[model samples]
Target: MVTRVTNQGPLTGVRVIELAGIGPGPFASMMLADLGADVVRVDRPGGGGFGAFPGDLLNRNRRSIAVDLKQPEGRDLVLDLVAGADALVEGFRPGVTERLGLGPDDCLAANPKLVYGRMTGWGQDGPLAQRAGHDIDYLALTGALHGVGRAGERPVPPMNLLGDYGGGGMMLALGVVAALYAVRGGAPGQVVDAAIVDGVSVLATQIHALRGIGLWQDPRGVNLLDGGAPFYDTYECADGRYVAVGALEPQFYAELVRLTGFPPDGGDGPQDAGAAAGGEALDRDDPANWPALRAAWARLFRTRTR
Candidate 1:
């Protein structure tokens, strides 16, 4: 048995075993560690994670030890750690851990109250569960990538933010926390299968609802929140830097217009700051006037510094 020191936070007494991988799994463990869980990262011998970078922020707030899991000694060491842990996080294709004798069943047998959080690109039992994929691939399959970028341009990758961290890591962390809560309430600990594809789909719930209500279109960058609206996108400044615009509400848009000295209409018309952005001659509600408004905003923003 090894003694561990935990920091002061919401999860002060909780212990987590993070089987080192990359991206989402590391991020999930990072969140737990941030909340003051004593996260023990089990790395393979010779060190691991992001080219063994010492400053990998995702591996922060935790202790780490290298163990060669291919050998019985290493596997036994991990099982010993699992026996005392409240949760375990691992990100790999399905069956990888099972083959390594570190699967949920193995760890759960060692500690039945363990929250076995599994992070993957697909899922545990899906058709592509064992397939290789990255954040972009998961987003693409979940219709998230399709909605990004301009209407006429190819889908632009939103980096790994959506699938890897937001959808994947956040969901896994939430699931672990929820499972821990249940365990405290006398419920049995269980597996949390947080697949990036499923998580990204859940993240797009608003878009699905909008599509169901006919308020959203199927094409990219043609919706109210998908950069189709002139007031909801970014514009370039004179310094070649870009600024994001999210003045969705009328008052906010009016404030934006006031601050930027922008004319609502393309011409030098009366600045109806009190007009609702959803209606009136503000032209914000009309899709036909979007091109002109976008052009005018573009021209105006180009005159600003940043």
Candidate 2:
């Protein structure tokens, strides 16, 4: 009989078996736990992951069991858990799980209805599938790394946020839910190859679409959203602090102009924002005027405090 865990969440009573790993895998399981799934993490005996952080929020909302996969008995323990679980998550690179005798086939055999989630930098089968890589390597290969940062400067990693959490972990969690949803419609269990490369690529959909329509450029910066426009970028204040502005729409930009003491146009204002900043007048829709606007905003911004 399946025990019902009441009052937790919409996912209450759902059981997930997570094979402990780092980064994306644990984060995915944490999302599962957050949604009220009864997630049981299988940590290696006396070999729990990344001992540096004790109060890891990722490990919360889930219980753990230690087992030695090197031992046949330990293998049996995980298989037994699989038989009673709704889904299983793992982040072993390529064939590591297969070598451990705990691949998708083994787990699926244990539970015919199981949704097996495999998280990796590359996918299950690709040119780079077997290549060892981390979040940076994956993001670099996916064109995402080339799309960030200030113009003419090196592209900055958004830390591991894009690859590990948003792209990999959150994508895996979404895939799990989607696979589980399919099972409700009489679909059989299947492997969810949640690759960080693939996930980050998906995150670039809008940019890709914009590029196709001649709106986005291939350079690191110099785009509407990626720190190209003055009104949409960060400014350093007088206190050595910074402030961000995102007046994307015309109305918002107008509001910003009205408030920041910048003129709405090169019109009859007492202080011409473009002239005072030693640049030509700026027209919002004219790409040629963007740099002038950026300079004007910068000059004004430097005069303010945080």
Candidate 3:
């Protein structure tokens, strides 16, 4: 029998209070819960009255408490809950929680050590912070969308993975955990301003480094890792599906040549027999040679498939 050992989690004793809205707030809470934290989600009365069942996986792994914050009793109820909580997460656009009388000031006044985590797109102080936006718009402002897609084509949106989940929600979770660590040694209460645009820019740090080192080109699909090198790209097979080829190093390229039956001694191998007859060897760096290589790979895949 294959045994899988499941150890007790790192956040087994941590407690978090989540003010439910949508997107990053619930996702951060779910990550905390997955690490064994006790996260309580405070939902609006009538159970998120604005929509249908919030069956999103991000909202799972937490207990829900419906309360009407418009009423004084509900405000007092949240204050009571805050008294025993370690952290609170909210994703309202800046002043919305303050208007609801449940902002960081209100919660921290009750619990001096509370770590308040705020999630948004443009941040807490920018002019567009209060304006409405989504993942694509946020990534567009950060130049992340421009770095994607092929050359001479419109920028392809990467389906909310970049801005909302990676930049907004995951960044907030990291901030909350860091704040908790800081507060363990007598650090006072604090707020984490996690903006999607800001985090997306931070996520581009490696690309920026590549640009500084002259490794990254201006145009998309014209760099080594960006589909410029024919050896480091995908090719269509005979079945019209695709297979990725990433033989960057010399040894890996040699292995790829051996496996594909290309030229082992700078001459053509069995795989490039047709091309060799035409006075051509498999040169992966040459884009003009891609068609021949692609045809050979297609023939190999076609013969193997039923």
Maximum-lDDT candidate: 1
Over 4 Å off, model 3: 1-8, 48-54, 263-269, 272-306
RMSD after CA superposition, every candidate: 2.9, 3.9, 5.3
Best-to-worst ranking by TM-score? 1, 2, 3
Ranking by lDDT: 1, 2, 3
Q: Enumerate residue pairs that collide in model 3.
A: none
Worst 10 residues of 1 by lDDT: 271-280
Tens digits of lDDT, candidate 1, 1-306 = 224455789999999999999999999999999999999998877774453587778878888888998998999999999999999999978998999999999999999999999999889886888788888899988889999899999999998899999999999999999999999999987899998988899999999999999999999988899999998999999999999999999788877876666775565444445442323455678888898889888988887788
lDDT for model 3, please. 0.78
In candidate 1, position 188 carries an lDDT of 87
lDDT of candidate 1 at residue 126, scale 0 to 100: 67
lDDT of 1: 0.87
- lDDT at residue 96 of model 2 (Cα atoms): 85
TM-score of each: 0.92, 0.90, 0.84
Candidate-wise lDDT, in order: 0.87, 0.83, 0.78
User: Which of candidates 2 and 3 reaches a greater lDDT?
Assistant: 2
Candidate 3 lDDT over 70-185, as tens digits, reads 88898888888888999999988889889888899999999999999999999998679789888999999998888787767778888888898899899999999999999988
lDDT tens string, model 2, 1-306? Answer: 122333288778888999889999999988888888999888887755553166777778888787898899998889999999999999988888888889999999998899999899888887888887788888888889998798999999888899988889999999998998897688888788898988999999999999999998888668889988777899898888999999999778766776666744443345644443443246776777887777767777778797
